[model samples]
Target: MEVLGRDVVQEWECSRNVVPSAFDSHFHLDRSGRVLQVYSLERLIGHAEGPVPEVLVQVSDGVAVFCDPATYPEVYPCAPGFGSAVGLHPKKPHASVEGAVRLVEEELRKEGVVALGEIGLDWTTPEQEWPLQESMFVGLLELACPRRPVILHLRGQDRYSSEVSALSLRLMRENTSPTQRVHLHCFGGNLDQVLGWSTAFPRCYFNIAGSVAQFDEIQRAAVRRIPLNRLLVETDSPNRRVQRKWHNTQAYVGEVARKVAQIRQTTLDEILQASLENGRLLYNL
Candidate 1:
């Protein structure tokens, strides 16, 4: 692919020989093992393989999800560059707690499986379902080993609710060890929440997604105040909607890193490099 009249792949290949490539720390795939984007980059745009210099991000490092159980055997063995996690997402109403636990336990034994989550509580669900969600979350937490990172998917009533945040912190503290590495996927917490999680688990890394561009004041403050070492970047690709039908891709992770750099008053390369290192450490990439 070419960007701005320059061949991006050639440049990426050359630069990658010298420095580490940028990592898209989180993304999702459908049961068919295809990236969950509305428009296929290769069909709509030009070749979608190259990472552009616009934000100096490169190829994927890891942290993509096979959201469906059936995709496990078919996808993981073939996908060489992706590190996956297997857990029931809190918002998935169709997933049964017992079945989810069994599936998670089975997948965690695989070599390609790197983390144990995108699991937690979603306050937007009916209050009666909270116990079910908590039950699955606690069961998955029991399977979390300190050797692998635990990626959390947390949501509240709105962008500002602390109810889910506080509850998640409490649950994690009680269920998981302080030494367990944690990945807070698509983090949008306030500074106080950041402090709360960091105080409890110093190894926790907060992931800032492409939605960083839409963050409110408190969310942006949390990003700015986040420790440099604890910072990570993700595309959460195919999950971010740019328009009515168009969805973002792994390339958007670079854009997120750019916004993070601007927010932290640091260089773009610094953010990208830090994220690459942090992701490698967290996911054992």
Candidate 2:
């Protein structure tokens, strides 16, 4: 597809004449799995099927239920459906715990929807509303305990992480199984914090985002303590950071690959190999 006048993403090393079988651990594909609107899932799949690459996609729901109509059915049916998570996003009408539980219950039952979150309390979200966020998270746990894999979005400093940990502990208490694979997407924590969380929960998986490309904390010490098999990469696309583009994209997934390789002192191909395996391991794809 011809990228028009907007800040078109120039093709990078990730899309270069790379070999097939390499996987991008995390990416926010349009529900339809199209890129630049010009490149449809049909196109991407076509390229991926070629000898150069075979990408496993993890389609996400930002804040709204974009899957109401399965914006990704075109590609969903054609590939391994990696499913999506849901919650009362920051911009949406905040649902109370009861209401959020009801929504999560419905989301978990959807055909390709395999998980129950992208949910957490953000400190900057509003003080008075925190109770509701906490309740919703608790409710999500109630509704999704059977479906243990969850995507997390935590904002703020240590307080946020601590609160999140506390909430998680509460959920863990009620969990029937000890295998909740919780993914902290674009978590803003230092290495010590990441290690702490890793040591805290056996199922905790720290997701590396674009900021890892340059941030010393994320790129260095923190990534070291975590086992590569337990690590995953993501591009919380459309969500910007202080480190780079305010929003993220699939292209950034490449940067994620790069950063992971750099941190592990390995090659990008090695990063791809492990990331792909981790995706299957964590998401059960």
Candidate 3:
């Protein structure tokens, strides 16, 4: 039995929440789900009215706000589903971070946006800009703490450079609160740390992506240790665990979700119901 935040996703990975279904835990898109802002007078009216850019459409889906913007799309524009999170990407420009957040907050005020981001520190990139990253991220947490759920972006897998770990720990400490919904999406850490955090933080959820889908070794020897309820899934797109295509798409969330169910050894139907419930629980849907 896989346990996640007291919930579970069984083996065979169910399909309650799919394209035809009304729920999804997490999803994204780069071009379409983007909140178009009237940034420059130089590129005004025409840019606003033209057919919305089609980024991740697969001819059978409608995109929704998610932790990864790369998963959101233009064409089949998901028919506005519920239980989601949205935010500026870590690698994106400073303007994207600042501007997209402003828009997201505005959307939250309107009940459109759910999470504060895919905002957090990345050890995978240059360290010289750590302070800039820390500063901007704190701003996001501060901004988001009172308003919406936070979709976190944490990278780096153990054994050195404590800087990333330190930064991440600091952010977690500073941003946490009673009401905020925090999700450390696509998480990576040793088994002890994962369990520690999962035990310590009841509100947080983690996404198991990439190699974890097929039992690729993570630093966590007991990767399956996390419960079915605390567990979530994502394609982390453009690249796939089962197979890769030209780009990653949200449609594969189900495929990955199923793998997660199998690891948990629960029924797909149970996984489906529980995953949707988990999403609602995290995002307050």
Candidate with maximal lDDT: 1
Pick the TM-score winner.
Answer: 1
lDDT of 3 by residue, 156-220 (tens): 54442245645665667666764455676666555665665565566656666554544545543
For residue 94, model 1's alpha carbon misses the true position, in angstroms, by 5.6
TM-score per candidate, in order?
0.84, 0.71, 0.66
Q: Taking the tens digit of each residue's C-alpha lDDT, what string does model 1 give over 1-285?
A: 453322244545566655436777887645212543323222211113333434554554767665456545543532445577776678774367677888778888877788887788888888999998888888778888789888888888878558888888899999889998888988988999889889999998999887787888888899998888999988676665222133555645667888888888888889988998888878777
Q: Which pairs of residues clash in candidate 1, taking residues 3 or more apart in a chain or in different chains?
A: none
Residues 85-139 of candidate 2 have per-residue lDDT tens digits of 4544432334365665675576566565555556666667667766776665666
Among all windows of 10 consecutive residues in model 3, the one with the lowest summed lDDT is 3-12
lDDT of 2: 0.51
**Per-residue lDDT value at 165 in model 2:** 54
Give the whole-model CA lDDT for all candidates, comma-separated. 0.72, 0.51, 0.50
Give me the runs in candidate 2 sitting further than 4 Å from their true place: 1-17, 20-78, 90-93, 158-177, 240-247
Model 1 weakest 10-residue run by lDDT:
38-47
